[model samples]
Target: MTKGLKPTRLIADSSPVMKVPTAPAHLSRDAKTEWRRVAPILVERCILTIGDLGILESYCSAIGLVREASKHLQTEGLVLENGKRNPAAGIMTTAQTVALRAASELGLTPVARSRSGMSAQADPDDDTDNPLAVR
Candidate 1:
C-alpha cells in the first residue's frame, strides 16, 4: 500500500507453541482460504508472530487477487471485447509478484526456506551439518 518496499525482519521463536492466527473478518473468501492454508504451516514452524500478521494478511490478499484474476482469465480469456488485454491478467501478474515477495519474506519459498531452519544466522562456511562433505 505504501509507495515503496519496506524491510522485513523475521523474529523466530524456536519451539514455539502452535498458536495459529485466525483469519481476519475483513478478508475476502479466497483470502480467508489462503490464510487457512498457510497460517498453520507458518505457525507450526514457528515462523509467524503477531508482528508478522500485517505481511501475512498482505500475502493472503495478494494470493486471493491472483486466484480471483485467474478465474476471470479462464472464463473470459486473456483478451477483452475492445481487443485489449484483460485487466485481470495485469492483476494476476501484479498480485503474483506481490505474493511472491511476501512469500519469500515469510520464508515460504524454497530459497528462503534455508533460512527458516534453526540457526537463522548460520555461517555459509560452516559445513557442520554436512557430515559427508569435505572439511
Candidate 2:
C-alpha cells in the first residue's frame, strides 16, 4: 500500500481491533472481492466502526459498477451504431466518481489519510502519536 505508517494502523496501538461485518449478501461478486480486500485494511487501521458499513458497501458497489461498465465499453467499443458515445462509458465515469468520493470518506485515499493527520513522510511501523490510532 502506502510507504508510511497510516494513522489508522491499529496493531500499533494496544487497543483491540474491531472488524467490520462481512460483505453484504446484496453486493455483486466483484463488490464482495473489494469488500474483502479493504475490510482488513480498515480493520487494521481502526478507521471503520460498524456504522460505516453502508459507506463501505456504497464504495464497493460503485467500484463494481465501474468495473462492469469498463468491461462493457471494452467489448462493445466506445461508440454505438449511431456513433453516439456508449452509455457504458458514462456509467463508468459516474461510478468512478462515486467510488472515489466514497473511498475518500473511508480514508482509503492518500488525501484522506493526510487529512486524518498522517504525514506522507512518517515512518512505517511507528504509530506512536498517530492521530487515528486506536487508544
Candidate 3:
C-alpha cells in the first residue's frame, strides 16, 4: 500500500492595495485626480521654486488680480501693474503666474508692484535668476 500526499492550492489575496474614498459630494473622479496632480505640483513649486526667502500660505491662496500681481513679482521679479521690470502690463500673464507659484514654493517673499506705476527693481542676488539652481 502506498501513501498519497495532499497538494496545497496557492491562495492570492486579490484585494486593491489602496482604497481611495469616494469623491466629495461634487467632484468627479477625473476632476479629483486632476486636482490631486496639479495641486501638489503647484504647492511643491510654490514651496520649493522661488526667489523670496519665505511665503505665507494666506498670500499663496490669494487669487484674482492681486494674487496674480503678487506672484509675478515674487517669481519673476517683474512689476505686474507698471511694467517697470516687466516689458508690458494690463493683462494678466500665465507665464508670470506659473513663475510666481514656483517662487512661492521655494520660500521666496516677492514684492508686488502697485497699480499706480510704482516699480521695484529685481534682486540680482535672487536664486531664481540662476536657472541652474534647482537642477
Tell me, by TM-score, which candidate is best: 1
In angstroms, the error of model 3 at 130 is 11
Model 2 lDDT on a 0 to 1 scale: 0.80
Candidate 1: Cα lDDT at 113:
74
TM-score, candidate 3, is: 0.21
TM-scores for every candidate against the unseen true structure: 0.76, 0.73, 0.21
Q: How far out, in Å, is residue 17 in model 2?
A: 7.2
Cα deviation at 84, candidate 3, in Å, is: 52
Model 2 ranges off by over 4 Å: 1-17, 116-135
* Candidate 3 off by > 4 Å: 1-24, 47-124, 127-135
The clash count of every prediction, one per candidate, is 0, 1, 14
- Please rank every candidate by TM-score, starting with the best: 1, 2, 3
Error (Å) of candidate 3 at residue 25 is 3.9
By lDDT, who's the top model here?
Answer: 1
Compared with the true structure, all predictions reach lDDT values of 0.81, 0.80, 0.37
Q: What global local distance difference test value does model 1 have?
A: 0.81
Error of 2 at 4 (Å): 29
- Clash pairs (backbone) in predicted model 2: 8-45
Root-mean-square deviation per candidate: 5.7, 8.4, 24.3
Error of 2 at 60 (Å): 0.2
